[model samples]
Target chain A: MPQPSTRNRLLEHAEAVFRQKGFDGASVQDITRAADVPKGSFYNHFDSKQDLAVEIVHRYAGGTDLSPLGEGDSPVARLRAYLLGELERTEITGVEFGCLLGTFASDSATAGDRVREAVGEALASRSASLARTIEEGQATGAITARRPAGVLATFLVDALEGAILRAKTAVGPSTAAEEIDIALDALRP
Target chain B: MPQPSTRNRLLEHAEAVFRQKGFDGASVQDITRAADVPKGSFYNHFDSKQDLAVEIVHRYAGGTDLSPLGEGDSPVARLRAYLLGELERTEITGVEFGCLLGTFASDSATAGDRVREAVGEALASRSASLARTIEEGQATGAITARRPAGVLATFLVDALEGAILRAKTAVGPSTAAEEIDIALDALRP
Candidate 1:
């Protein structure tokens, strides 16, 4: 196996490359070049580009900081903070690629069934986490009672994904922020 | 130059292939094979893959049927018809590939600046059309005044895109329809 740092660097830089280029658009050569690693080193670490993509999905989801969802005083407040934190992460990373999960979702149709499953599960996991807070908000009367908390959580995540796609084309925060706020606002009583 | 029928087949089959495989995932060879045209004949019809993609975007957007948005009795009812019509279309077409416009939006990052602009304009035009209906809804008190008509229209489009992304993974209309309905419901006064 390659050194630990080389493996880490491959994951980091390849994520950026994959984000910039869809699964088919980006090549191992592009990823290696981005990571500044020897082209031959790629196979030594990953079985294939698809294998690397799956790993990247796992690592990206596992690495998200979800503490913001629990930090604020009210449930609605926490929900807003968690979502805005997501927006903040996208801006800081590179809205040009949008959210890595979303990027994967967009490319999942042809990236392989495994990639499709990975993104689907990742999106569902995030939605579940948000649902917990939304449920609390509904109980506390901070959110509306018309829709199920779980349904509302999925709406927020779905809208956020769409907004991220816009940010990819807009290459900025304004449009995405506006779209996300609309979903968040919809949760209100 | 190739015959008109050959050119027409290329467009129809290329849209399907690209919708299924994405811009980066689909190649001239793949498109030609699907269209049953010679690979070399591609260059005779278009300058490059990018040029073909630009034309595809224009054609896809131009081909959408927006009559459903205008046929219903009330503004809100018309909006619902339009959205449900979209759902019906996704079912009739391949939901596994989602909307062609959205597929391009997702792939636009690496596809090229021209493709990106093509998708951006397509999405904006659609959003603008939706906004006119929303404005009418607001005037008739079918939609809330809390947000501008344009803002609500953009939100609906963004949310719909996200739902379509989910359809790509689920390979069905159930989840996408539910997600889309939530956004439509949010527009209620």
Candidate 2:
């Protein structure tokens, strides 16, 4: 096992705390204290707490290997795989803070261009990947949607994020699953 | 128009700040200071910040009489009324703090039963009301959902909330409006 670096440790601990406290609620002191790093060392690693948050989101989303999702036999299976992975990850991490993309979307302070661009990238990438899978399913006559692949993918993402928001508030994952199930049914061949 | 009562002023200001800044971010000082109430008077009004937040969520959702939605021509119209009202209100407010129910959903501190129940009640009430609307729509052949009214309503609420989540984040009501348009099209007979 690769031993965790100081930077990695900071990122992991920060992600966990931010997931719990939110951007405004979280403080730099809390993160440093949680990570067992000297307060000054935090600045050494990242420009600001906002910078750290952006990196944390990138890591959280990328840290999950999406290969399994694409490996599923059918488009629906692939999409389900992606969503189920998200559900299990949240349950396990107890981070259940909602999707970082959606969370940022709900945030007003995220008006900074850099942060918005990063989140926009994450949203676009997820949507595009899902759209590709959906399009392939359509080619095979395995799925149908009144909206085009991109629009449907956008709706699915929107619904999933909303479900996550509800789940986060309700402190349960059941609604997220239900929402995904409905979206899947709607996209059925 | 009846002049705003002190309590109403406090609640209104608190709602705006809380939605814009969040529970931890919006301090009693900020709320009271905004409302021009004596700082000490805050304790006289609510038990604590958490207590204030609970009241805020209840007051915002409760203050609005749903009779307009309930009296719409059909279930689809009723549901649209509920959603469109939210969209318009959020747009006009320009605070874009996201929905109170949704804001809580993202905060991990809201895991407690009391807080969860408060948020859940708001959601459940909305969902039930929307289900009635869907039933009416289906009966009139204005909506063509194949699922039970309850299930379809749940989907619509979740999707609409997700759309609002995006809108709040973007600080633009257009996002929610666009998503609602798609949702409405889907429900068309």
Candidate 3:
């Protein structure tokens, strides 16, 4: 693969900075500094910090690896694999940073319409993905169908996001993992 | 009751401003302007923004009305009442603003140790309160003992926080209410 473009580099670094410092806390100058690109170059790529934020949400949402969920033999296994895969990603990002979607979601109210819409779409997509898998689980009799699959999917997303938030504040990733495990276990038939 | 003091007034207004704009987004000027107090008086009431944030977390945590949970006869009723009551509070705050504890939790990693600790303690207290209720439900055979009550409580808090985050991004409170109902239903034996 070829090297990432300057815009890509900015998105990559900006995502990390925004995750760590929040949308309001991370200035354009800070992102530029992190990307090792000139401040002027920022506007050359994205119109404003808000614009970059919407792009970042889109990029992060698109990058979620849902393949591991498909790899497992049973729906329960697939769901577990999916959630654990997410936990691994959280570990890679470090517990301190948490999930980008969640961070953005928390700040969405104050983040303006464009960013909020991006975040809303991103979360809705994620929940939909989870819901599809849950529907599969219900069909396979591996998960309870006590509630609608969409509701369960939303619950999963919420639990995972909540776990990530807790992990950010706690000492390590174990709290997050444990909390997630309980949530996944709750799905068992 | 007597009228709130100047410091109390600042704390109240500052909490709302911080909730609306986040800790980094809301500046001293905005907070003072909201409180209708001179800028210098801010320092007199609190050492710094971080100091005020810590106090806000404390006040918010202490003020959480777990009394509704106590009022219900069954564990499930108590849990539902507690969560619905929370939803009402969220409505009062407006879903756009989300939960203060969750908002702070998402920003905790970047918010420095004092703010992080305050948020952690506030969340932990909330989770513990929920856990005690869950434990009561378990003993009464109203909830399953499949997982430890503490883990279940954490899951509940996580799901609720996540729902609030979604509510902030979504069109209305119905999504939050539905998701919360599903999560509470999951607690059934």
Worst 10 residues of 2 chain A by lDDT: A108-117
Per-residue lDDT, model 2, residue B1, is 90
Query: Model 3: runs farther than 4 Å from truth?
Result: A1-5, A171-174, B1-4, B171-174
RMSD (CA, Å), candidate 1 to true, equals 2.5
lDDT by residue for model 1 (A56-139), tens:
989889988899888758887787788888888888887777888887887888899888888888888898999999888889
Residue lDDT tens for model 3, A1-189? 998888988988998899888888999999999999888899999989999999999888888999976775777677778888887887898778889888888888778898988988888887788888889989978888877888788788887888888778874334776766667766767
Candidate 3 lDDT, B2-29, residue by residue in tens: 9887798888898899888888888999
TM-score, per-candidate, Cα-based: 0.94, 0.86, 0.94
Candidate 2's C-alpha runs over 4 A off are A1-3, A110-113, A171-173, B1-5, B64-68, B71-74, B108-113, B137-148, B171-175, B181-189
The TM-score obtained for chain B by all candidates, in the order given, is 0.92, 0.82, 0.93
By TM-score, how accurate is candidate 3?
Answer: 0.94
- Sorted on DockQ, highest at the top, how do the candidates line up? 3, 1, 2
Please give, for residues B48-156, the per-residue lDDT of candidate 2 as tens digits: 7777778877887686557756683666666777788876766666635667777766653533556666776777777777787778788878776576776667677
Lowest lDDT sum, 10 consecutive residues, model 1 chain A, at A166-175
Candidate 3 is graded, for docking, as: medium
Steric clash pairs (candidate 2): A105-B169, A169-B105, B75-B133
For lDDT, the strongest prediction is 3
